[model samples]
Target: MADSLRESAVGQLLRLVNRQWLPYPDERPEFQLPDYDTPIDQEKPADHISSIGPDHQPKRRSEGEEQDVEAFQLAKTATAERTVSRTLTPIRTSDGIVLVDWYTLDDPENPHNWSSPKKLLVSFEICMYSFAVYFGSSVYTSSIDGIIERSGVGVVTASLGFALYVLAYGIGPMLWSPLSEIPSIGRNSIYIATFSIYVLLCIPEALVDNFAGLMVLRFLLGFFGSPCLATGAATFQDMYAMIKMPYLLAFWAGAVTLGPALAPVVAGFSVVAKSWHWFAWEMLWLSGPIWLLMLFLLPETSAPNILLRRARRLRYLTSKAQLKSQSEIDQAHMSAREVAFDALIKPWQINALDPAVLFSTVYTALVYGIFNSFFESFPLVYPIIYDFNLGESNSVFLSVIVALMIAMPTYCFYYYYWVEPKVAKHGFGPPEQRLIPALFACFLVPVGLFIFAWTTRSSVHWIVSIIGVLLDIPQFAASLFAANDFARSSVACGCILFAHPMFVSIGVPGGISLLGGLTILCAGGLYILYFFGANLRARSKFAAK
Candidate 1:
């Protein structure tokens, strides 16, 4: 009885682990589940010739009847096409190894063919994961003063906790994203593994006594939690067709933006109630549950990885040694230099040399930098000018969230009405067509800056300055043109480093005016790029077709 119970417990544990962490076939109910009692298999090829039902199956006709014969031929051709669609077309290598792929376009094993509700469940989980990870970056900032007092560190030294964390996460994707792409490694494994470490590290971070230990811990936390920021979009691409991806990605951007926006307020309140250590404790509390949720529910989303596992199963079942996944086959031929070029050099190559890419990268980096600059500038503006407490000052960051809420639906409507029709008809217009909305929105950044610069005072209502901050929140280009998220984050890190000093030296108004002036210059540059971008793309080798 004891031996039987042990075996059963082990079997259940294996099944649970396989279901949660491993790549497996999706078995979700179809959008329109078929009735099993229907005589689907008995239906003949020419039965579909009728518009109504198989009851209208062609009756026997005389041999001389040419019209009926022609209809039958068309029906046969249609049936052949349907048969081909369901068939498994195997890839054979030079050495005769069979490369496995989806059994059909509509294969349940393929992530793309999963039912809508299943895909949505996975998408929301990843977005929530992104929220928890990004929420860590600013949660520390809520208690920077507490850090300064407890650790005997200067404000500059304490600020390194935030700065280093941001910088490390930006650098992390170069390592993590590529690893996740490997068929054996896969996205789900990387997410749960690294995030578990990140969650555990929070405990040490909260207990650390010195500035150096805390900074290192924060950096580690950011580095491990970095995968969901960039790779989460890749997962969406795996499940969603191009037509639907833009809308889903818009939600993803909102999730990422919402995290940092809400974190400060929560952390600020916690810090006031408890101590700075509570910020890390709160991070642990937030992330630990998210990790548990992901471990149980986040199935592996990488198609290549799914196929690789399927290939392994096929090898076992069929007793064939030659079965391999496309990814494994490619990996066999791919050299170190090719991997390096793709992972490292290519993002920078296009980013630096292609005029369109450079313009997009710079624009995104600048906007992201400005966004990060807020964490620094808000401390200067709200607390000093408005004389608000910590929680109240951080509450103003909710304006960013408000701006995102306003911008998302408006962009969705524009994409549906304006962009989708063009794409559906012409199959994507000139790249310049994408810049149309940006051309109008670019001016708003500086407008918001100048408004905030001029209006942030004792005489003005705080809402007016927040409105200025709200105006500064126009950034569609960041998501559309971000070639490399880490590179952009690194640029934003530099901006974070620069912002506090600039705001301190120049005062809030002067510093903001300077930022506004710089954005105006960027707007002028964007105008030139919008009109002349094709000429620049014509000259470049690396521009996306």
Candidate 2:
């Protein structure tokens, strides 16, 4: 009887151990490992919870030998369900697929998945805004005489206003570009806010009685109107896939070039018909419609921003504690100072230290400086030598527009048919390949500058000098566009800043001749890049990618 009592006690102990240490049959299925070879159609509950949840909290374990299996299983199941409830409520298809991206595959919130018509509309508005803002920057050049007379500033001092405006805008992007990338303040918001401020500032700029006030207002206008220069290309990247970007970017380039080309014509007539203030009013009128279009039409295109908004909405609706966007989650540990340093300081460092960036910047800067200098020199050449009025002098810039119209389409055909096909069949060619067209075009810049410099005399037909400008502008535009494609944002902006000072120092024919000589040196640099860019990129840590 004592032995039988002992056996019963042992059996009870064994049963108790099994119940505590091992889960029940129902719970086994929940914790079972998935098939390793097969694809997971449905995201497991645990996997979904872990991805979106806050960091797992530490729990204290009991030191006692015995534990409650039923309680543990119940707790785990509740935790998983709560996680599911709080995080992204993924759509599960009848075929067991889980869709957990920021939006449904066809969701309109994703810019990439936007309808073709919507994409076109947004692109058109962005291009138009870019055109208008750039036009505003250059229109003042046409009113230099008015500015000189009204402000009582010398011609050089009045020209300084334009130079400072360009410089300020170039630097402005260094700050605004980084800010626009933030989720809370996206591309659309930045564009809308700055462009509005830009439009308002134009009024003060127009009405300013002194050169100092005009200069200040001009600087502020450029500072506020910088988004189109800094972030416009990024917008295209955000909206379109790589396949469509070439054509879209080409179109954008054409629009941007058209701005400066058209500005002289429009402001020339406006200033002659009215006062210099009318030029500012013209800009205000043009910008007002652009501002409205952007406010209504431009959708937020940043992927991180969209995902962040979705995450916030889910958290609000579900009241889940740990739900976060991938960007938010990744950035959770980064300090504000670190973020600022990376965004603000790092770009300058890259521009300063990276050879590839330096070369590209130098090339583009040379082209830009020469192009802007034409504004000052064209009137000197055309009016005196050809006996033209301000309107006729301004009309000369039409050759640039014509050249752009011809060059853009031709380059697009070459890129789409020849260059892109090679890239497709083989791997990506070296960065040097981007400079091939630029190599040939760089030679034309010096040729055009020399031709225009020597031929701008009464003896030559007016067409000869215009032809010279025509050759240079198209070649410069084409080369700059190509180099820009390979350059970093900071590098491009820095180069633009460099151009402002170079163009401001006016010496007429002497300056033109100097620029022509400089073009020859720049052409040599282009050849070096064409031959050695690949090797340089391979060695550099921060080479263009």
Candidate 3:
């Protein structure tokens, strides 16, 4: 009876809570005579309440009782488990900690409860938005040649425009993303700032006197467009339920990876056939309306931000009304300044301090490099090998996109129809299911490479070489899923860690910067994913690490 009671309490506290939730179990012991400046009396429900020991007798526990905790409060409390994801539960104590949740499955507030039409609407809009915003981030690279020709900059110096743009992505999100949680200013401000910055960066492309200025401006353009690129960064929280997010993230994962590959095609044409400045102006025009639409249509997805706004409204009306405080707001949240500072340092700190996290970051960074190589190798391949002009060579890169389009649906079908049920039944995450597609992809890589490398000749039909691109379609998508799934899994310890402001509580991963580099990186990363995934099913330590 005692064991069952304890189990019941634990199960309620842990499992019945939000899927995004988990508490960091504190390992430390509590101090004796714990300081308490104030105490409030509470009415205990006679039915649910019980006293430990015989006849409901109560006494102050002595030294020996400390270790075992004769009753509940007898043990020195190091930490109490609170729901991790920081969702706004309805119940609240004076200090604002929720003692128990009254809501869980199918809660209307949960993104999972959103209507299918709404979900699809948001997903489609976001996809287009991400496509346009990300295009600006990398398409600017296509104009590098025209800028170099016009400004007479050397080759190495000219490439900085491309390098700097990527660097902006690494830097800007760290600063601007936190403001996304501030009320009325949240994601709206982020979009405005990012676009404003991008517009400012465009000035150099329009009026620069030298290559250096053009390079600097291009980098800045990417820096500003960064927040825009990263805007969908939190969409997973808004569009899908906890369990549902893994499947959707696969497509999100693909879109982010595919963006860099596709950009060179657009930039290639604008630079080769027209002036360099056209690329900047056209991209800006294309994305301008989408950004404006986001201001009004982008709903508040961060639950804390929504709660902060709700609390303010409650205070406005009902002068005699009371609002409950949550435990997290009291303990984990900080002033605006501290949050900004912490957000800047958090990704790097988490990556460095956690070995598992560090491995995942490095692994994904390689994927980014591989994706970027399309820009590098496309120019090299068509012009050097096939004698195609700059514009013509750039179009060839589109072959990879054709492959991605075909493969994307295959992956979606596998996950929704075949894998989601298994993940639910086994407590396994999306990463474990990621292997089936990735194994197919890994085998395709060499075959594709052989075809692409050997068949681009007049003697061979052009279609023969194109088969390699076909193989890469699946390779790109599946490899992308492996890196993201593994990194996301590790970031939470092993499966899904508790959500804190500092970590992935919510976020996702990036793409190609080479063939050999990406291939080697993919091989190594996926190999790790395969081995760990296999062992994970049999071992509990690795399962919940």
Give the candidate number with the greatest lDDT. Answer: 1
Candidate 3 Cα errors over 4 Å, as ranges: 1-112, 178-185, 199-204, 207-209, 228-233, 320-328, 331-346, 429-433, 456-461, 477-521, 533-545
Any idea what lDDT model 2 has?
A: 0.66
Candidate 2 lDDT score at position 502: 48
When 1 and 2 are scored with lDDT, the better candidate is: 1
Question: lDDT (0-100) at residue 474 of candidate 3?
Answer: 58
**C-alpha lDDT of all candidate models, in order:** 0.73, 0.66, 0.50
Give the candidate number with the greatest TM-score: 1
- Residues 130-160, model 2: lDDT tens digits: 8887787778888889887876766667676
Could you give candidate 1's per-residue lDDT for residues 1-545 as a string of tens digits? 22111112233246567633322332223332212122233233322211112222123423433454344334432342212233334544434465556665346556765556667878988888888888899888899999888878776677888878888888888888888888887887788778889999999988898878888898899899898875888989887767677798888888877787789989888799998898999888988888776766666778888788778766765567876676776777778889878877877787777878777777767767776875588988788888999999999878877889788898899999989877766876677887787788888888888999899889999999888878776463244226666767777778777888888898889988888887888788788888999898887777544
CA lDDT, candidate 2, residue 328:
68
The 10 consecutive residues of candidate 3 with the worst lDDT sum are 494-503
Q: Is candidate 1 or candidate 3 better by TM-score?
A: 1
Model 3 C-alpha lDDT per residue in residues 20-53, reported as the tens digit of each score:
2321111113312111222322222111111122
lDDT of 3: 0.50
